[model samples]
Target: MADHVLDRPPEGAAADWTIAQDWSAYSAADHETWDILFARQQQQLPGRAAKAFLRGLEVLRLSKPGIPDFAELNDRLHAATGWQVVAVPGLVPDEVFFDHLAHRRFVAGNFIRRRDQLDYLQEPDVFHDVFGHVPMLADPVFADYMQAYGEGGLRSLGFGALDKLARLYWYTVEFGLVREEGGIRLFGSGIVSSHGESRFALDDPSPHRVAFDLERVMRTRYRIDDYQQVYFVIDSFEDLLRQTIETDFAPLYGRLAALPDLGPADLLPGDVLITRGTQTYASERAGG
Candidate 1:
């Protein structure tokens, strides 16, 4: 099956614009795909993923086989963090997506990926959107951060700073790491969802993991097609919220405009370095 894209609602469509989720449209193979990804990630995430994410699995009862019903999940989610999942045809417009988040509704794509595309899927499907993301939303601190990000996203759109703001989401929401008593653990949805990236991110000694700094992160660029060359680690979700909430990014963007971007693997004198990656994997890939 091809990837799904969000379409504009038809005239006189419901005010909220949610499509009736075609639950039965899902084939056994699709359910199997969800099952495969779920089981694999569950087995791989024990020590690597943050404790909150794991607890969310049990709280949300995500261990059950097959795709989860948004209605059922919403009951638990709404009660826990006042966040509910809403099904969209696929990726919504930036404004729409932000509006949903700002209101504490996470817009998720209802479809699952085909089995052949297991290792890497280009677009986020139900498994990626729900399994990878929703669990983290159950955590209060993380939940607040997402809502704030949504409001910030809307502000950024108006200021033509969406790209800069997006880097914040990518670094923190998607691929961030956090310092735990056990050492660095995965919190970012992008890393927690993948079997290979999860292992590569933590166990492999290839990427630079530095403390989270808003300005530095906004100035940095990330690779979309491969593993990150650098990962920013946070002390706690509270630390993440406090830093971003207290910051007024308009001035920060001005400073960033005057500076050069850091290469994915480049190290800086100011960075509080966790590990200076050897860059072996990235070098080998470039040669190949």
Candidate 2:
């Protein structure tokens, strides 16, 4: 998840880079902030978020109140999918991240965003990490895919293909869309967590929507600073899991090493195009 790796854990963090969530430390204002963000997403996500994600929100009872205490949240998440959320100071080293995921542990930052920064945050906060991602982990299929991805990540490190592998996580986990009920829906954390992106991802005509292709996703470059110019859509979580677990990535990594990286919006003749965007948004942003 992090863009770069750190040499070691920071102060107060365990060797695994985990810190106590200390739920009691949050102030009343903090709870209010969490409520604000939670309420907004709940209002915006209806008919927009993936069905699995919405189901997760209901099953976890994330609506109960303020910031979720890891102790309580884990009780529900673990029972549902054997996944637990662990607290990290911020982004951990890549290995530390993958290790946590491989073991079905998700690391989330302990802090929530300031009220004024609600619309955007460069680093993920609890709201973004938990409200955005943890719900999806509650799904059995997506949970399996996450763990498989983590195990794959370890092997990727040995091949020095982490960059390529990271693209898979970025495109699928962070900014992915899924085909459902005859349309594309938001399944990616990056879109589901943002008020603006939740709308733009499905309603806007400025971005390309392509069918998910494993090798294609691995070779594509993604932008971290703005709305995604392209999104990869999967048929279903079952298919996504089957594709991840059945594929032999060793050779794929070798092939990817020799290929040139593609820009986020690049279109190929072989691609299964859903939306051939005008790139109007990106062009306007760049022009401005």
Candidate 3:
């Protein structure tokens, strides 16, 4: 379970929570884990991830050696984008997460993954949080999209539409792509963070990359335990904001309520299909 947003800090607390970010507690092995992951991802991201994401890496000075000090990173981030990263134990509650995002404060899990779990980790660690997410936050359009999503999240909570809204976040923030002059480039944190997924997402023929449709996305399902079966593609971050911000979601939610949910790889009549995936990879997984 994620941490709840409304939970109050203890009385007269020196900081917000008791989980003092014992920086020294990080052993040499832990630092090694960060270094290895950082080096690998940095090498892989070029030509794969969006330009803005790469620029963010330079701006944050994250390309330097060893694990980054959160305090130092925040100082630079706050100055650049009015966004700051806060350390949390792991996934926090929906409201808590939304509240932080609404205020341009991203709550990242402070821990880094152990070397053994490099390929996959069930929970989001510093690699997933900072490496995957932070870079894009530097872009003004993407930054606005995130803050708007946060406000929408809080609104969705009032309407009991968190599940639907979460699907949007998962697809857009976690695994979405954007069309560029050269070709489609990665923007979603999930795709940017994974070495294999980065290649698979662009090079493979097993998943459909369709133009982003808000109504379709809200009714679509996503996979958590494996690679994404379908990915939504956007023209630009500006397109994302223009489409989403101009429309009120109340009616859209009502419209989606009457429709059936789409499976991970399933394409519909409404989709602006880029590729009709063969689904060979997904099918093999199903068989196995």
Candidate 4:
């Protein structure tokens, strides 16, 4: 899962949700944890992750055997997408988060997960932020989508529609999939970040892999506490970008305000179902 923005910025900081990375302060264990997690995911992502993501790993030098030095990493990242990574203590507030995105800056959590908690952590840590999220920023199309999402996020707030916009983020940025030439592959950072979910999201028969639709995605709820019960599939990154950027969200948001919502497990007649998932995961979780 991704970390939300923390409510308070540090005392006297110029920007919200940003703090110095203190890159030199990390211990040997911290870097070791990053390496282990990085190696595990590196081994795991090849066939499952988006090719753009893999290329990003190399371009960013994420497999360098330690938590990345942000200054060093930024040199390459900025060259690629005009995006730079910044450090945050944990989650930051929404407005601050959108503001960063609008400006093309990514906020990352500075700490690494514990050895025992390597498989899972309650909040996103360094590996999750850098390994999971940063690579995609290397891709121009995905980079544009993120910045647009950030701009849309700020606009959505005025409409009292952050929840709707957040669902779009959940389905697209956090848990999205795309149909590649041979088959569907993972693009969403949430799935790419987790070993179990990376496989489960593709191989498991329990979730719908439906074609992405703007309104259906916005009104739909998502599962953050478990493997996603549904994943939206896009034809290409351009398809995702064009849809969001071209749409007049003001009217679309107004239209969607009155519509009934869907659950993580629910599918509608209008949904373009790619997998028509068996949803055994949800049933098993509920002990049905």
Best by TM-score: 2
Residue lDDT tens for model 4, 20-104: 8899999999999888877878888888898989999999988787889999999999999999999987788888889899999
What's the TM-score of each model vs. the native? 0.94, 0.98, 0.93, 0.96
The predicted structure with the larger lDDT, 3 or 4, is 4
Q: Please report how far candidate 2 places residue 10 from its true position, in Å.
A: 1.3
Weakest 10 consecutive residues, lDDT, candidate 3? 10-19
Model 3 agreement with the true structure over 67-118: per-residue lDDT tens digits: 7788788788888888988777655667767888899988787788878899
Q: Against the true structure, candidate 2 has what lDDT? A: 0.93
Show pairs that collide, candidate 1.
none
Q: Which residues of candidate 1, in runs, are more than 4 Å off?
A: 1-17
Q: Is candidate 1 or candidate 2 better by lDDT?
A: 2
Root-mean-square deviation of Cα positions for candidate 1 versus the true structure, in angstroms: 2.7
Question: Candidate 4, overall lDDT?
Answer: 0.88
- Please name the candidate that would achieve the greatest lDDT relative to the true structure: 2
Best to worst by TM-score, what's the order? 2, 4, 1, 3
Error of 4 at 159 (Å): 0.2
Candidate 2 C-alpha lDDT tens digits along 29-80: 9999999999999999988899999999998999988999999999999999
User: lDDT score, residue 209, model 3?
Assistant: 88
For model 1 the local lDDT of residue 206 reads 84
Candidate 3: list runs displaced more than 4 Å: 1-20
